[model samples]
Target: MNVSLNEVEATAKRAARGAGYPWGLAEEVGKATRWLCAHGIDGTNSLAQLLEQGLAASLKNHRPVEMQSAWAGQGVLCPIITGALLSDRSDLLHAGPIRIQKLAVPVFLLPFVASAARAQNIVITHTCDLFRAATDGDRLEAGQDWPSFSDHTQITLGGQLTTPRPHVTRATPDPACWDTLNRFAHRTYAPATEESRLLGAGAGLSDND
Candidate 1:
């Protein structure tokens, strides 16, 4: 029996939600996996297909174990899981650039890369080509401007420290102009009439008493 990619995607989404990931995050994972599968990453597709097959124990067992290879050991790297791991350990990865070789389902890994970059306050570049990094790194200009993703392959990630503009400080004081206020405060009232004084409260009526 075969299943459509959409169905697999739906199932994966449900499983992710059931497993306790927030709806928004689960949705992100689904989209990431789909992107990876679209890019011909076998692991991404396999995960989708596995989900459609009911998430059997054997399928769960097939999840890729993280190997310390240059590119995930040239096997299918589950981007969904990898992204989760990266998000969890982002602080550690931020200390330096980390590389994964032969990454399976590489597209799925993009969210994790982006999350790590944002968390570490830096940019991330992932690619199969090595020479491009050296040349691009030299040619690339750095500034406070954000990086664009025109090219998907051969990623070169970095951040620019934008120089802040100097602020000008000036000394000033409030202008003096308040004849209206002075008039109001200095205004005097006529002494109360005898009839008014009799009705007035307390001391106003009885100065001597």
Candidate 2:
């Protein structure tokens, strides 16, 4: 219910870590989830599903491959890593419009698209009328309409990029999203002992701290 964006981002990060992502990748997932909510996409649900399906653990052999017209991988690809890689590789756009055959959470790729566009000096076009990438990634401007979900996503690069207007009011993730993420994150915590409970975070004025 009406959670803060910071809360959403933090929770997503913790959940990713719980689900076995490295801290760096978990940080990317957190930022991506926050970015998705900023643009009116259901990143919380997307991430929740990604973890629920155990895609993170299943990714031993499902690394992304550059396809004829799309990027594909066995099983489902981690959107956070895929997006990060795509942004870093500025030359991949030369292969024409690229599609991810099965992006577990394509919503997480939007911000990376913007960043990639800036890096490659090109514009990223999607099926929607509202992807607003600010000159600075932190200053992004989200609008009314964002892309809808699908099994696959196609990305086209062209023309000069424009700055999008920032969303006026912040959006909150559904409670179900938080609940699901929390359940996942719970797996990371050790079973609390008496000392762990009473002296949480730092032993609160106790010498043992």
Candidate 3:
């Protein structure tokens, strides 16, 4: 079904939180997912897939580890965590391109990179295999071959900006993906109880007035 970007963000936030991510990270996921959808990427499915993996395995395994010239994890890296770290230490971009190996859902990292670029007032380029993407804080351009998952990727601080892609106000998420997100988001709801349900009413179970 067609939905507004705001709807996507809210649902993504709740889903992330319900999937065991801290509120702060969930908030990040919300913004990132919205950004992706606006740019015509399938962020809902990516987030749903990530949440499924997180629920099925230890998130610690996805934590990034520094290597000689790149970062790697025991398993595929979670883009949300990695993206936050990049935003936190955006200055690292000054040294050189940040290379991350075995990154899951690399597209989700774009918003974080774009945010960092806007903050630093610079252009950034992200590449994996044949896929290429670049953002200059305001505008973004990516190859049509953007992959669902990337085994290895590199991000650089400076690059030539491409023509901006028009953003949409609405997104039509895949039905299966939307259902998965709802399942995760549902975990945040509290079970209904009799007292809670009757709290707002002036009378109890039996109301004659």
Candidate 4:
């Protein structure tokens, strides 16, 4: 189904919630999808892939993100949780750049870096396309020197102290992107039971005159 970009974000948010992400992280995913869509990148497909593959389990179990190791048991780090930790303890970046042994869906990881740039009042950089975000959240600076997210299994990310103002741009996502998210979103709705349906919204009212 073709949907507005706003609807795309809202549905992904609800689906993420139903899929067991905490409300806060779900909210982040929503905004992230919208931002990516505006950039002409399909973050919805990346999010759906993560859910279908049950990647949240890897995230839920891997807390207290550290620099010395890969996620325990799972070979890759969950970006939502890892991103949260990275943002929360951003001071750790002062020591040096950190590396992830393997990261699933690199596109999903960029939003947090953008947010960190805004929150910390500095420029933030990440693995995907080597994009850098400004502190005002007004720009994403990138050059053609970087590779696509699909080409990498792991990456290094860090921050720079510079901040610059640049023109902003956003575009509507393709219809195919909306369809991809709906495939997983359909699984999130609860099946209505007989009793619940009888008492559910507008259940007791009828139009008969």
Whole-model lDDT per candidate: 0.41, 0.69, 0.85, 0.58
Q: What are the models' TM-scores?
A: 0.38, 0.75, 0.91, 0.70
> Which ranking of candidates, highest lDDT first?
3, 2, 4, 1
Candidate 3 C-alpha error for residue 68, in Å = 4.6
lDDT string for model 3 (48-121, tens) is 88888773245677767774489887888889988988888888888888899988878888999999898889
TM-score of 2: 0.75
- Candidate No. with top TM-score: 3
Number of clashes recorded per candidate: 7, 0, 0, 0
- Name the lDDT of candidate 4: 0.58
Report the lDDT tens digits of candidate 2 across residue range 76-187: 6777777788778757778776667766545567778777777776566543222433323444443444343346676666643355545423556678877999987887
Each prediction's RMSD over C-alphas, in Å, is 25.4, 4.5, 2.0, 4.7
Which structure among the candidates has the greatest lDDT?
A: 3
Q: What TM-score does candidate 3 reach?
A: 0.91
lDDT of 4 by residue, 78-148 (tens): 66676666667666556555455456565666666666666666665665434433222435543322222
Query: lDDT by residue for model 1 over 1-209, one digit each (tens)?
Result: 23344643454455555444456656766554443333333323334332333322232332335434232422344445556666666675534555554344344455455566666666555443322211111122212111211122333456442332222122111112112212222322356788776677556655784
Candidate 2, after superposition: displacement of residue 10 in Å?
0.7
Candidate 1 structure lDDT: 0.41
User: How far off is residue 205 in model 1, in Å?
Assistant: 92
Quality of model 2 by C-alpha lDDT: 0.69
